[model samples]
Target: MTAVLDEAIKKASITWVSVGDGPAYALWCMPVESSLIVVTGPGEQHAPGLTSAPTATVRLRGDHGGLIVTAEATVTRLDHAGEEWAEIAPQLAGKRLNASGPAAEVVARWAATGCAIVRLTPAEGTPVTAPHLPDDSAAAPPRETPARVETRRPFRLHRVRPPRT
Candidate 1:
């Protein structure tokens, strides 16, 4: 199961994570050693309650885009001034697409803004996989946000014509 979990994490570009019973959030993750790294804060992705939570449930997708595995992970926040950050931050920045600037600059900005770099280490146990998976699709309604389309409908191009004789 460990091998399977590791391979899934490596192949996955994004993973769904839910802390406690909160809604799962899709976060861009990088497989670092045996753990997955995710960044969240003002300028990065927003994963509410993740930084404060000690454990989280992670769902990885397979090649067919279905849920492949679900595992419980131990969460650890990296200290920006620590050596772990010194080594991992650059790698994460490089993997980050559409970064505002170079890797070094991006790392600097994240540190300055106090972004949370979270590492999720999959716990050793029997992960939910294969035939044991749920039968129904776990789809949920979209969360409400302030951003929405408020524009009126567009005008018709052609005018209505009178009935033909």
Candidate 2:
């Protein structure tokens, strides 16, 4: 089970996660051991209403209208310096975009402002293969030879001759 999730996370850099009743939102994620670590809030990426949620729906590839995994969220609020912070800060830093300067400094800044590191531990049940997938029979009847809507172009076309040397 762990092996399966590990492989999937390694392949997909992003996960569409929905916390509480909030909408599913995409977040850049990294797999750590059996859990997924995602950083968000303030100056960093934003996924609102996560901190308050108990569980979340994490779509492997944003649902082709189906597949997803439900997980329990473990929120860790990092302090400026500590043994745990020492280890995790570098890994988190490695995943962040356009982060400059030393590792400690970057983490320090993150601590200064409030940033929540979320650990999503996959739930015990089987990965959810959502019910109700669309089939050919369910598709809307052929659009009666397809309707075309005329659209206006923003710019007018013009021909210009080049100057001769």
Candidate 3:
């Protein structure tokens, strides 16, 4: 792995991943060995098509919170019963923030819910890095969701009264 890629992966707790032609989804990840591990499912972070897609584009942000590197990565879904999962699941659980339960319970829940644990391995090629980065900000409109902000009149501290009637 290139030094820049290694540094970026090691430092980033989250990354934006695009599978196939789908919209990029921000996902929390843990760097395990030379690959990044991401969990996605019903209750976990949504990464549409990541488990099924063979390849994905991963963008990592630098300390300044700007895109630093973009690379093509091969996606591999780890089997829940496999040895790799046995070793990595606990680590991922520990890294997971605000988990609903203990690490073991979290892992069990993931297994029971058929959550996907995917490893993103950077493909062999020159990643798009600084100085060669795209000029466009690549911003896109937010996706439609059921969530909405409630609109209400502002709270007032004082109100006009009829001259102490």
Per-candidate TM equals: 0.92, 0.65, 0.91
Tens digits of per-residue lDDT, candidate 1, 104-157, equal 999999999989899999888947888888988899998898877679978889
**TM-score: model 1 vs. ground truth:** 0.92
- Comparing 2 and 3 by lDDT, which wins? 3
Q: How many clashes in each structure?
A: 0, 0, 0
- Give the higher-TM-score candidate: 2 or 3: 3
- Candidate 3 lDDT trough over 10 residues, lowest sum: 156-165
Compared with the true structure, what per-residue lDDT tens digits does model 3 show for residues 29-114?
99976678999997999998899999999999999999989999999999999999999999999988999889999999999999
- lDDT-superior candidate, 1 or 2: 1
Q: On a 0 to 1 TM-score scale, where does candidate 3 land against the true structure?
A: 0.91
| Clash list (residue pairs), candidate 2 | none
Candidate 2 stretches greater than 4 Å from native: 2-4, 62-82, 130-165
Q: lDDT, candidate 3, residue 62? A: 93
Which portions of model 3 show Cα errors greater than 4 Å? 157-165
